[model samples]
Target: MAGPPRPAQPRPVWFEAAADGTIQLFTPSDSVKLRRPRRDPRASIVVAAPPGERERRVSVTGQTTVEAEGARDLAERLAARYWDLDERADDLAAMVADELIRIVRHPERVRRFAF
Candidate 1:
């Protein structure tokens, strides 16, 4: 979710890019991140390589929408992708039990550089 525009308001979120080239993330329906985006559809995501890795960065700027569908599915998929859920399956179950909204970003521009 993207924070409101102001001093130091820009932030990063755990988002996944589907094969269709759209970004998706799940957040509680009441998240503060949903507040500003609902007011303004503009948003962006920036990704950088790990600290010890070579310098590579990707940035995407886009318009966003909050949707009611696919939050649980996305959450489940991401949990598995990023975690060894064999020992924490219940944690994922609990997370998906909440009222979530899927934040979708439709990219209008993308920038990438590696050095």
Candidate 2:
């Protein structure tokens, strides 16, 4: 459950890159993502360059921690960052209220690759 994601089952999740350089995302409290990482604190997140851009990507391998605080706020911020929340306001509020865990990864190794 550490380093680059399992290529056979890579999950595409929305994430926020914190100013402190940690990668974060919210998941249901009982999600496998939370379960696996709890049993094994090693994890990695790979982000590819945006569409219409040159081929490049970044991979971060790190120790992960699940936080109980700030999940709602983080969710709101991430939703706005990645979507036009104006249309999904209700959906956002509803999902934010669900039991959620914040997965924060503190990077031990960060690699950048251009292909």
Candidate 3:
């Protein structure tokens, strides 16, 4: 038997590859994306390479778990990676002070394609 289809809500996110080959993502504690996974750990992520002569893409399918304790650290790392956090350390710290969630995906399979 099948139930009602789940709603699709897509949003851009930054990700980092962990040494263990898992993907790490950070989101606000209030985000639905963070909440929904608790009910269903299954998840997938797709990333497309910058536009060029050929289009390249990678997809990962796996299960995710919320790591609350690591969220702050990961959020700081992400902020530093994407922005000059050191220049405005106070602001960055204040921003991350709000509840954050760390979502770690254990990759079950990975697929890459180029066109």
Question: What lDDT does the true structure give each of the candidates?
Answer: 0.88, 0.86, 0.85
> What digit string (tens of lDDT, one per residue) describes model 3 on residues 13-32?
97899999999998888987
Displacement of residue 57 (Cα, Å) in model 1 is 0.6
Find the number of clashing residue pairs for candidate 3.
Answer: 0
Among these predictions, the greatest lDDT belongs to: 1
Off by over 4 Å in 2: 1-9
In order of appearance, the predictions have TM-scores of: 0.90, 0.87, 0.85
The per-residue C-alpha lDDT of model 3 at residue 58 equals 90
Q: For model 3, what is the error of residue 66's alpha carbon versus the real structure, in angstroms, after optimal superposition? A: 1.1
Candidate 1 residue-wise lDDT, 1-115, digit = tens: 8666653257756789989899998899889989877988888888899899999999988999899999999999889988899987999999998998999999999999999
lDDT of 2 by residue, 1-115 (tens): 3476544337999898899989988987878777777777888889998899999999999899999998888888889987798899998988887988899999999999997
- Specify the poorest-scoring 10-residue window by lDDT in model 3: 1-10
- How much is the lDDT of residue 81 in candidate 3? 88
Model 1 spans > 4 angstroms off: 1-8
